[model samples]
Target: MELRSMRYFVAVAEAGTVSEAVKRVHVTQPALSRQIRLLERELRVTLFDRREGRLELSAAGRGFLPVVRDVLHRADAATAAAESLAAGRLVHLTIAASPTTLTDVVAPFLATFGPQDPLPTVQESSGPEALDRLRRGADLAIVSQQPPALWSTRTLAVLPLWAYVPRDHPWAGHETVDLDELAGQPLVVLDPTFRPRQLLDQALAEGGQALADPVECGNAQVAQALAAAGRGIAVVSDDPRFDLHGLRITQPGGDHLSITLHAAWDPGHHAAASLSALAERLEIFCRTRYPHP
Candidate 1:
């Protein structure tokens, strides 16, 4: 019949006495006994053998114990799943980030959650695509520029631009290079759709220099690889994961150019609360990992 009645039956069967079952089920002995009797009546089968002041399971009770246990287990599991979903703990979040941030920022943030917690799905794209993913129902988007004024956004980190020069290059000997000095140097840059490229272009414009025919790569690691191979200098965010073994990282001199990263989500989305919480965590993680000067 009812789950409560089934629970009472199981408790009494396991405890071997109505008195013992009451202690476990936290009901009066009479109330528990009534439930067991009601259950047996409903099933039209004798559930327990009571003799010599001890109770033992009857054939019917033995057969039903396992079934009742399974039912209770399933019910409990279903309840827990429902509660988790309502709390937003079980939602499968989709996070969109540029490839460099996915490695340098999102990966480390994920590491702190431990293996037991469900991980968010990551979508690696350039800034524009990442933002587009957010608009199309991604839970969060991590990008180098703030989202448009209408979107909900949290500033995560501000990173300075760094130049990766081939180890054999003359600039490798210096700690930093000026923007003017890099003028006319073939540059390995992220695709124009990415924010870092826009920032680099703006900085170059301000410095009265320009990259006439830069080698464009889809992501930061590729740009680094191209620079390492001496194709051009890679200008990117100061992400440590970019392999610098065959390159020297140089900071831009004077009014160093920087990019601000933000986590953005659509405010009207159903997961807005969860996404906002995720954005907050990302901001805290980025601040701890890359503290602003």
Candidate 2:
């Protein structure tokens, strides 16, 4: 039988009378009665015992009541889930970013969302990997440089590259150092897998300069720590948290080297509204804290 007939059967079963159920279901008594009769005929069992101008559930109707209620409840739940998905309120947003970006940008951006709002899941990966995860259905990605043509992006901030030097180092006294000045220095560098490191390598190659047997780390914090210990100068993003008294940060070649942070997402994602909201909040935070000059 149709779900509609099942619902009519339930209403009549619950209300215990045809007239009462018809009023509750907003259907004519004849239509409700006809559907109930059809359901009973289809099931090949009497659903109700009619006597003394009142209706009572038969044994079979009592057995079927709970089953029909369960089906309707499950169907309603499925419909609600679909609606939630359409409204961008159901899925857990996945944001992929580099470790530095995760610490500096993504974490803070997430804090701006209300406690009641759905929290996003953070995925730390290299720049290319972050975009790759986005391509593979991640809800958002934070990366350096512009996104590919297929993805939509919002530029969050333009961050200058800085040289972290030990207090006793000769370059510590200088506010900035030329690109040539970094040549042959014992430097602490992030792993070449990182996009920032690749950009720095490209610039150094173009200028015909290179670090002298650099110390390598997977992330900037470790590189900064190594620099603080006087192992070597560290090249890192200009985050104030990484600035220590013993470690002075200097711009490289007076802002000749810098990177722009961007939030990217597939425009065709089903949760476009959620992605847009996240990007807007991140952009606002970046503008307030790291506004480009």
Candidate 3:
């Protein structure tokens, strides 16, 4: 049966009458009725029971509806894929990442896209939840956690968490601050939802370090503002704001504290190559944007 006929059958089945279906399908009642009859003939089964000027789905029609819907959905997807191929790039994509990653990295990387590049939609997600976004229709996910074995993943960047302070602060002239040292100072920290904060928490727990009374805030910019106002050192990975100086946070083991960003996508995606290419590009962007000493 023709796809158009299948659509008409579904429309009639859903609308419960040819007259109502005609309004939806934008065809005359006779034309729609003829299409439905043609569809039933091609299928060699009655799709609808017509009685008392009403249309109701027959047993076969009910069984066929889901199959036809699946076919139509696949057909539309194929058309989109073909169009994207013709454009020589992805036409659109959706990326999932934490709010900080979205703000500090993905948002800036997206700004470099040319006119013909795929337009990206962003969803706020964190950690393992970012990978779950793929199942929810996100084309790509950027997460700090290692993705599942089945997913195609690339390391995008390893960005340092910094101890930010106003220029006049005592530690402002220092190139780095030990986690233990930072722990002993008055602190300005973003909430645990932020990746930097999560990493910081883990590092502190590992070192058995605890902060004295610290200021907690939700926004990175606001955290920097508090630090600029001399509340404490802002411990975050966000780009320096409010003219604050940032010192690389260090562990006693002589390692800088950092968060590693990974880009992940389903291997079975139709545009898997495009997604991988985009991930590689993001990696390169991050390397340049946040160079490590």
Give each model's whole-structure lDDT: 0.76, 0.77, 0.87
- After superposition, which runs of candidate 3 have C-alpha atoms over 4 Å from their true positions? 1-79, 86-88
TM-score of 2: 0.64
User: What clash pairs does model 3 have?
Assistant: none
Worst 10 residues of 2 by lDDT: 242-251
User: How do the residues 68-127 of candidate 1 rate in per-residue lDDT, one tens digit apiece?
Assistant: 987875675456457557865744667898777888888889888754455578987776
Tens digits of per-residue lDDT for model 3, 226-246: 999988899988899999999
Which wins on lDDT, candidate 2 or candidate 3? 3
The true-versus-predicted C-alpha distance at residue 148 of model 1, in Å, is: 2.3
Model 3 residue 88 lDDT score: 75
Q: Model 2, 158-239: lDDT tens per residue? A: 8767777766677667766666667567888888887667777877887776656888998788888888887887788846
Write down the TM-score of every candidate: 0.62, 0.64, 0.72
Which ten-residue region of model 1 has the weakest summed lDDT? Answer: 242-251
